[model samples]
Target: MTDAYYDFSPLYRSAVGFDRMARLLEAAQRNGQENGWPPYNIESTGESTYQIEVAVAGFKADELSIEARENQLTVAGRKAANDAGDSTERTFLHRGLAERDFERRFQLADYVVVKGADLANGLLTIDLARELPEALKPRQIEINQPKPTLEGKSAKSNKAA
Candidate 1:
């Protein structure tokens, strides 16, 4: 399939890190379009802040796990059947939403961190902030005063002689 945003031709001769990001985007696009599983949305909070919200109903806080490793953000959920003491039979006539389990990953920029997560009304919201490295940020360079000209130096030496 033709890439929607990435051009492999230019990336072939480029650096390795960009190639990896391209590959990651490709994988994400494929997985994102493949199974319309729990829908999600990504929005930019500011210049370096962002948020990703997913519909995760019937999932508790303990049933979810979020991890950030090697510039990858992974969100996973596993709902285990409760089988202790309490016994109740419940049936749903029209069951549509998924409450099973799922794993979703997002490739993050350097120094980007997962700030926090909040679950409300069946939506799982994950916040992220991109904190650029010191070296990567722009800095002002102080200019020094110019040294005495060659002509001035020569005149001073002649006066001394």
Candidate 2:
């Protein structure tokens, strides 16, 4: 855990192309003290593919929403209110499972795109894949072979006897 008020001025002064990383670190530090609800896991399914599973026990498929915009992925869940009358309500002796609504966000790297999402049992899984553009992909440069020059060949050619 880091102090929420940590100064990043030194990092900014000595670094280049690291502004996004600094922002991410600052955001994490600021949200460090927050409670970890609806725990999640991020896993690499392939060389360039990933999956994020979040435990949303009581939330239904219809009650959850997934959105991807720019470089951010947001998942939110809300329990719908029951339409039944309050007269038929029953109290629980031990309510350990939390049914509170929650919203979770994940920052994605460049070229990473959300493939799909599925909710089954009590887990919500979001799939992602990285697709690099042709211009950005690594390429091999061909080295040209130099043409052989004719030895002793000048502006005047030697006459043969």
TM-scores of all candidate predictions against the true structure: 0.72, 0.74
Global Cα lDDT for candidate 1: 0.82
Least accurate 10 contiguous residues by lDDT in model 1: 1-10
Model 2 residue 75 distance off true place after TM-score fit, in angstroms: 1.3
User: How much is 37 displaced in model 1, in angstroms?
Assistant: 1.7
Give the Cα error of residue 103 in candidate 1, in Å: 0.7
Q: List the residue pairs that clash in candidate 2.
A: none
RMSD of 1: 5.6
| Local distance difference test, each candidate | 0.82, 0.86
Q: Write the per-residue lDDT of candidate 2 for residues 54-156, one digit (tens) a residue.
A: 9999899999999987687888888998766756776899998899998887889999999999999999999999999999999999999977757977435
**Residue 161 alpha-carbon offset, candidate 2, angstroms:** 18
Q: Tens digit of lDDT per residue, candidate 1, span 51-125?
A: 999888888888988899878887888998777775887689998877778888777887999999999998899
* Local lDDT at 122 for model 2: 96
